[model samples]
Target: MKGVEIRLQVQYRARVDESIEACHARFTAGMQQFGPPFGWQDLEPPPAPYIKPASGDMIGVEWFRYPIKGLKLQITAQHRHELSIGTDKDTSDDRLSIEFKTSNKALDYRAILREHFPKLIEAYRGYRAWAVFDYYGGRYTDWNWGPWLGREATNPSYQRLCKEPGVDIDGRNNIFTLEPAVFWDNELCRRALGYGPEEVMRRLQGHALSVQPLLDGVYVVFDDDPALTYERFLEINKQFKELLGIA
Candidate 1:
């Protein structure tokens, strides 16, 4: 069977006053810790205002490693958008988003990430983040809000599909909260999980492969690699969500 690809990502609302130049400066400032990035390129067509040499226009970041084929670090900026979490009363608008992501593929990917993931999180300070191994398919945002919601027993999507009068298992939605991933970290852990980093570590003692407390958030790794067969992935994910009382 083909191996699944793992993705580690951090996502947060951009500062309202943040400028493209600022984003460029932040990337340059943080790159030193991870490694210098080269081969910068603009993501959009000509006259792309976000493009800046040695600073901006870079949607993907690559480091100089002797033999790693696809090892890369990516930082992407998104325009402001809104998602329908529920009813009109539940709507919330977010500022443009700033995301940082990396993948586990190359031989040295995990080693490098283990050493630098915390630094990346500190540099970006994302409110929601995850490290998951799933089939390469639809938008990450479409299926990833569950953990961000922490222990919410039900979300708008879940309620929409599972709670309507005559619906059965066939009508159940895939949205889940507090679902497990290979790795997790974010600034909202305390508020969302009802405990601080240390307590979270205590709670996850047996199930968690490793628990790390970072400067701004708690980092939890559930396994050596997020990638796994679909059945195995679901097994791990289910066990964890249930353990946390969020299944």
Candidate 2:
């Protein structure tokens, strides 16, 4: 697994899982691998057939950064494989994204982390963390389109993507991701549906290229809001399946 990691400073409410390697602890027994940066102390466990966290190593130059409190992260980084679209150098490996919190303002952890010489940890001052959730808890790569970031970025277009005829009650700070098998980058485009990005843009208020995901798509997950992006994606996907002659 190779990718860039982004750390931000925010105020979330949750407990901490001291170690990044969650292998020692698990939400359930017999769960293999501990990949996610956080312990997911807040996210409600996935329904029925639970999804255990997927684990793997991310090849990188070695670096570090920031945090927040109470923010829940429930991702099993199995989909650590992300492709570089525009440039052959998809330095996703260079990035390490995580959200943690500490009352120890006395400890200049950032300075200490850098002083040790492992690497420089960027200071994401005033960074706002988002609530990432999923139903089944899986990861995929088709979500990343390079320059276009997901809802995790500042000023995401949630109203157009998440809110619509009716808004999601808990859709705040929520964004959706789709499995590649479910749909792909160009499927909804004019070439596939006789409509261009503009039309899709008008419908979603966001470009497909802008739907960036963090770590294989685990951080983003599927659109939980059934009334908005979820249904829209499925509807468009139905047409795509018909066009592809898929049953």
Candidate 3:
């Protein structure tokens, strides 16, 4: 996993009937709780871009400056929403992507994972979301085009390629995930999903790196060791499947 860097992703549905401005405001307020100087730069260039707190449209950013050791965050937003609004209308899923790179050779990514990962998870209040820290979890790269020609390198094909080894093809066999997290979020205790967050914590008691409760979910760190490999991740995911009986 030389080229593979640790990625953090959180996926959830947008609030019912929430405008982009309202959504943006709520998001920024929550993130700001992580404290000042952790602010976003609107990537959508202004004739006046959406810069106002919580009341702007189509806000985007490439880097968010965080206070930890001058670690500039690479932020990507994939929240797709339509103009129509109603209680009956289904909200679209939104995602925030962050990355920790090897460029800062002086700092250990694992140390960052240990310290700020949960705080970052707490900073976002999504309707229903799951945050995860994994190597290449659902990101696109040249690997998709490496093996196939023009048509096959499309998004769906790339997703299938990323998922095939760690997940069942139909995407239902184990929690709708591909590369599972070394650190992950479980929102709302997931009672409807048949496993309580505490139960997962109990089951993974000794084996897990760390498991902490969030306001509405649980944060799990699978392994913190420097030697963790992709193959080892698959093994831990197998253990996860068995412990939760989701496989």
Candidate 4:
């Protein structure tokens, strides 16, 4: 079966203690939601004797696996912080500040993200937590909000799509594209552009979707059908390997 793997990054900010507690709470809550009695395991520490460059600084790592809609979801959390006070005497205050980071491996399902994510977001909103969906495959592989939302005028065609009605372009849209390709007949592209088949193909071939690089690999988003999307993914994967000098 053809499928896509996703990697997500969730960051939560709050009083150091509160953030840590919130992370723990999330893990417990997620496990219960999945109806599994999963447990968190500590990741191996950095090579032993890891000398600390500073005092009152620490790091913690933990991993948990749970079932979500019949798919195994692996969630990892990392906490890093320092205990110190600001050097500025006026604004200086001694307090423990921490950063909470979490991520998950994709689950085997058409749509792993049910209403759970919205609930999770709401639960952590008090701590100013934000979840980012790093879509790997599908029609959104190559889409990126950074440059599109930025002031750059690189791809005029894509820019036009952003401006089109019924197409939400706001940062809050949360929609992204991976390594997407344009095919001769993509209904989504046709509808989004309000163009005929010939025009759609012309625009697509004339301007390919943008490419974005992830940690392990790169993806592109295109105005192509699902079958074509998979084909283009293979093509880009080959090109990426060649560029990396990988056999």
RMSD of every prediction = 9.9, 18.8, 7.2, 16.0
Candidates in order, TM-scores: namely 0.56, 0.22, 0.61, 0.32
Clashes (candidate 3): 2
Best candidate per TM-score, number? 3
Model 1 misplaced stretches (Cα beyond 4 Å):
36-67, 80-106, 109-113, 136-187
CA lDDT, every model vs. true structure: 0.42, 0.26, 0.47, 0.31
Per-residue lDDT of 73-151 in model 3, one digit per residue for the tens? 5433333343334322112345555655544464565665566555555555532333233433332222333444433
Clashes (N, CA, C under 3 Å) per candidate: 0, 19, 2, 21
**Superposed Cα deviation of residue 25, candidate 1 (Å):** 1.9
What C-alpha lDDT, on a 0 to 100 scale, does residue 28 get in candidate 2? 25
Compute the lDDT for candidate 2. Answer: 0.26
Instruction: Give the best candidate by lDDT.
Output: 3
Which is the winner by lDDT between candidate 2 and candidate 4?
A: 4
Clashes of 1: 0
After superposition on all CA atoms, how large is the RMSD of candidate 4? 16.0
Regions more than 4 Å wrong, model 3? 1-3, 35-91, 127-174, 178-192
Cα lDDT of model 4 by residue, 7-69, tens digit? 333323323344454555654454344321122233211111121446433544343333323
